[model samples]
Target: MMRFIKPFIMPAVALAAWGTALPASAQDKGPIRIGVPTAIQLQIGRDTQTGVRMAIDEINAKGGVLGRKLEMVVADETENPEQGIAAIKKLTADEKVDVMIGGYTSGVTLAQLPHIARSKTIYMEVGAASPAITQRVKSDYDNYKYIFRSFPINAAHQARGLVDFISGMLKDEMKIQNIAIVGENAKWVQDLVPILKKGATEAGANVKLSEFFDTSTSDFSPLLAKVKDSGAQYLIVILSHASSDIFVKQWYDARFPIPIGGIDVKGQDQDFFSRVGGKAISETVGNFAVRAPLTAKTLPFWDAFVKAAGTAPVYTGVGGYDAVHIYAEAVERAKSLEPDAVIKELEKTDYTGVAGKMVFDETHDVKAGPGFVNLLFAQWQADGKREVVWPKQIATGKMIPPPWMQVQ
Candidate 1:
């Protein structure tokens, strides 16, 4: 079911029939092609691909959806918005994929939206946290109804979760008063920092130092020194794959007394400890898009994923796996591969996969509030292990602060 192909392998010919749904009679003829146009050059991309494959294999093993094999056609977008647009175009117009799943960066996802709308490809965005993707669906449901987001909470909602945890739990328990914010100067984090700062301020913490560095940055001494000098007790780092190892290593090397936290995507990797010594990332708190052991289905999936991929799945990988199943369930419910029929069935989704209960709201995004798919928080302990530590209902353990960050 998971078939890998080269980019642009599918030729584009028909134009006017792009947006129209496939005829019902023609739907049961062949495999269900699910195109994945993503930054396949990166680790995150590979992780996502692994998850997608795992899901596809499992589904196909179970006789697949609508009694047809689910095939995955992956394209390397090279982390470029223009490349993403081109890749999606090839996927929809050429490969004629029944649906599309993938997007690690927000900017690239936003760039591909117009093409997705034009082609009427059912796009389940597994990554990319920018709220605009779903907001656009809300604004023009008739046009953007084909779009859906399975992972990556919106910026504002992510901010609220970080604020609530820090203010309601960390601040009181650790006696935290001042904090600093540090992130890469990407569009997603650029949009997220202000929201984080405002939330931190509202939660009774003074923003000591707020800074953004280029993704290419390797030295974090300047930023770490500023945080130490500013008397900040916590450093909220907003970063992804780029510069995460450098930032963590430099932070540990500098012996900066402040505890690190925030949207640490890289820290979610199973190789984090090996990349930057176990002691280095210990006690570092951050949020992940999805963490295993959250529900009854998560652990089994994670174990199988690790056995197949030779590594534990990351947040993006979890998202990719879930997205495939989500699409399969929709197709099963619709009883047709027609784009319109599947889209309608998708709108009525109340399914739960490895990620969480995925029920699309009016905006075609996963609902995230009380009694919904809550964001996951975790902390790396000194034992070189990580565990879920928030949303009391699903927490695997209580958040523990490093001795340095604890009240004296």
Candidate 2:
């Protein structure tokens, strides 16, 4: 039988064993706890953990935050909302973490918000891109003031970026006409694909196919064939929880002629090329982790992360890294670890992070545009290196046609 679970129910056993928060002065004594709730098995989650640790390592080496060493604790949320709630409860109620840093799937983040509000522990969201997550802050600031996203802008802004990419890069520069939109059926993508379709049509292109696939979708052959039969000259695939690597491999194996781009979370991994056995040759993803030195800290962090994590970091990894530093800065400036004080300081954030300058808007989401947190498209070039190809200013290389298309 199908069962319906309560919106924010705590597991009875865990609730019974929850730990008490440390009193005022005692809270500042030991290490400042930073808890991470993520799908630990995924690349985004793995990088989130690494990014948080990188910041803690840097701060500790520099004599620590408020003279107290920083520490990270992890609980796997596994892309499940129930698991997400459990993870947040464990972090705020059991671990009593001073700050929480990590998120990937949007549904999971939405599910975890209420628990965060109740605990009043500051959460620096590193991954999820739903605009609704920040909407709560604008709608109910008193309760959701503890929430803030430090990376990758939001889905609405991201859709606008996609429109810009399709308009400038695909349409004007490449003379592309027909385009198709493929995205996961998740809340975030479902909300974004409409705006993208409208904007793409208004920007001048025949909207060939707009399809949403299930997250559990493994066989993409029929979908790819349909997209091909539709005569789409360019394809934009948006994926978060779905397995992007599999789709990329299938597309390559079929020698798909369409030039593909847009957000692919797994495709942002530094090792994705080899992970897909070089099947990601022409795959382009909306990425911020490209090594173009968007800021002075960008290149150094990239090199450091490579050495530390034994691979290149993804956009979410950079998000986590930025969140920790932003939180630490707020703590130092406010001269206290209290949630309210830190939140006020966070609202005034203007840190030039690995991607771009980080600042919260009226909704507490990062501001997006040129000179701020702009989205850049990065493609796997023929030489097996990823390079930015859009918006002109920071592009390392131009977007090239796929081998199959070039042959034609």
Candidate 3:
């Protein structure tokens, strides 16, 4: 009787101590924590967080993944790289999150990668399009096993599409000869220049001038003067949300008559266009993820997002929404909380998400399908509505340049 009682009593005591040490872990067996590092102050950041929240709510409402309720731990990165890294560290180490989703800027995303790898936690990049994220995967595949990006690679698909569309429109429609590539000197656009140049040459368009301005450049008069003197018929402007608005306004103020067009134009939110005003923004053509008309393929996502968020949908919002759903799908496929299993599931996915048919290539980069679904050209009309002008299949209206930009 004493021998039997001793063995049973010792095992019971050890179980009681373990349970007391981790009480919460014992009680709630079905709550997976997801860490979100948001740039709450930024427009795109706000929209992205909103989208992610909407997805989480919907998923929870419909019986969450792996029979567990989903929970989010949100931290503000403040649109700074250092802050982003700190936020990620806090989330991964302190909170012990199963996964992470958020990143508006390329620099922030790049800075957070090492920390994510070290922790061996899954990070789904929602909006950062820097090619380095995916391109590096091919060279250092092991380091990127935990990182997956939902947005199209920066300037690869879109830049190629823009060059082809612009050149065809110039030769067959606008009949222009020379073009200029202008962008802010940031990693986002610098990596794009070479790709744009290659595509432009293939399209038989002469790139007469390729200029890069500092992100801090407030005065564009000097740059506009150089562009005007270069005799370039088309201006391809590529800059981030804030700087793009500044450049457009300054280009108008300087009375630079070149027909401006580029990748950074249409993907931004309505606030960006409003900041420059309808009149000032009118007839400014640029390429974006989806055409301005919002086709059958895109309208459902736009509608669902607007309904969920109670606001107009933007590109970043779309990206965030897709990121959440994509991550959930990967988790379900992996059927485990481990990052390595989820990475393999993500690599094998061919999901048709809000951004279009998303298939993760060998390098962990999603291949956004062909044509306008992946990118589209749009022009800001006088009616405060941006119209799709290129990729005739989805064009809501024809290409119409501004009064100041009509062919000479």
Candidate 4:
């Protein structure tokens, strides 16, 4: 009963050339353009692009929106704010895409918002995690209602789950109290650290050291040395792909003997163990969106992705797949491509995507709870396996320290 469209990717250069071919009015016809950030420099960009393409394929096979095929125009954001703004401008002003989705970095997504608001094109966030995205809309709904996030929980909302998991699972269950908080020095992590600190304190956990480093920082020896000296039971991290593997490798090579956990995006990817290699991130735990076999939608799509890409869907992939379907459903419900009409339909969405029930709040951010798209905490086993370990209802296993930690 499912129909899928053939997948295609239009490079930025070709997209620019195509956009320039249109006259000033740029009459809307042909394919429905969906702009995406392919940021080949970042794996998450490529991961998300796969999901967008998959969703578009399914929609086009279903006859697409208003009889027009869904197509993707990609530009590289490279996890940079300036590049993100430039790519968005090209997609909106040049390519004239009807919808835009899949921004991985919080800073990059925020940088593109002002232009998106002015352009009035519907934008669905796939990976940006800043709480401010929807908050900006709340503060100025008249100008920013055009923006919506399908993936990536607002950092503020996720903090509660992260904290509670740490308190209940790590602290109480595992008897971990002294914790060192380390995160990337970015807007999203900065906003979360304070909340994490407060929650940890409230739960009777001691914060040994709270530190942040630039995303580009590769040498974590100094940071590990600090954690080692502090004698913390756990090192809570907030990081992405750029430095996640590097940190893990460094930690393992150094044999710091402390358990690592929290929000490590790259750590949750199916390829993480192979990519990082040889139990480097063993016993490492983090929260992620959708892991296969969690919900009905998860396994089907997960199998498809692994079949096509030789790997399972990452969080961004989950987000992109959901965003495309959400957009398609909106267009169908409104029966029009008019931005306002589509926005109205999007605002009323209650669809259950690959992750979970996606119902938007006043600010257009996914509501966080057990019944909704709740965060799943997972731990990497010693044999390079990952298992969900928290939120008992969906958990696949319990948290266990690596052999190295057990001896300590």
- Which is better, 1 or 3, measured by TM-score? 1
Q: lDDT per residue, candidate 1, 1-408, as tens digits?
A: 232422221011111112234456554688889888777776678888887887777766555666577788988777788888888989999999989998888888898898999998899987788888889998998889999998766776777777877786567666787888888888778778888888889889888999988888877787788888998877888887466778877777766677787787777778777778765454455554444555566777777666667778777787888888778877877777788999898889876666567788889888777655666677787656776776566677766655445444
Q: Per-residue lDDT for 1-408 in model 2, tens only?
A: 111111221121011111233355654598989998888888788888888777777766565667677888898888899999999999998999999999888999999999999999998888898889989999999999999988878888889999999999888988888999999999889779888999999999889999999999999999999999999998899997788888998899888878788999888887788888888887888986678778877878787777677788887789998888888888888777889889899999988888888889988899988789877898897757987888777788878777777722
Q: Please give, for residues 25-141, the per-residue lDDT of candidate 4 as tens digits.
A: 333578889988646555577778788888777766555666677888887877778998998889899999999987888888888899999999998998888898889889999
As for candidate 1, its clashing pairs are none
Query: Which of 3 and 4 is ahead in TM-score?
Result: 4
Quote each prediction's TM-score: 0.88, 0.91, 0.87, 0.90
Q: Report, for every candidate in turn, its global Cα lDDT versus the true structure.
A: 0.75, 0.83, 0.69, 0.78
* Candidate 3: tens digits of C-alpha lDDT, residues 209-260: 9988887888888888888888888888887744666677777666677777
Best by lDDT: 2
Rank all candidate structures by their TM-score, best first, as comma-separated numbers.
Answer: 2, 4, 1, 3
Kindly provide the TM-score of model 4 when superposed on the true structure, using C-alpha atoms: 0.90
Report the Cα lDDT for residue 284, model 2: 83
Model 3 TM:
0.87
How far is 75's C-alpha from truth in model 1 (Å)?
A: 0.5
Separately for all candidates shown, the number of backbone clashes (residues 3 or more apart, or on different chains) is 0, 0, 0, 1
Ranking by lDDT: 2, 4, 1, 3
Model 1, residue 206: C-alpha shift (Å): 2.2
Model 4: residue 386 alpha-carbon error in angstroms: 1.0
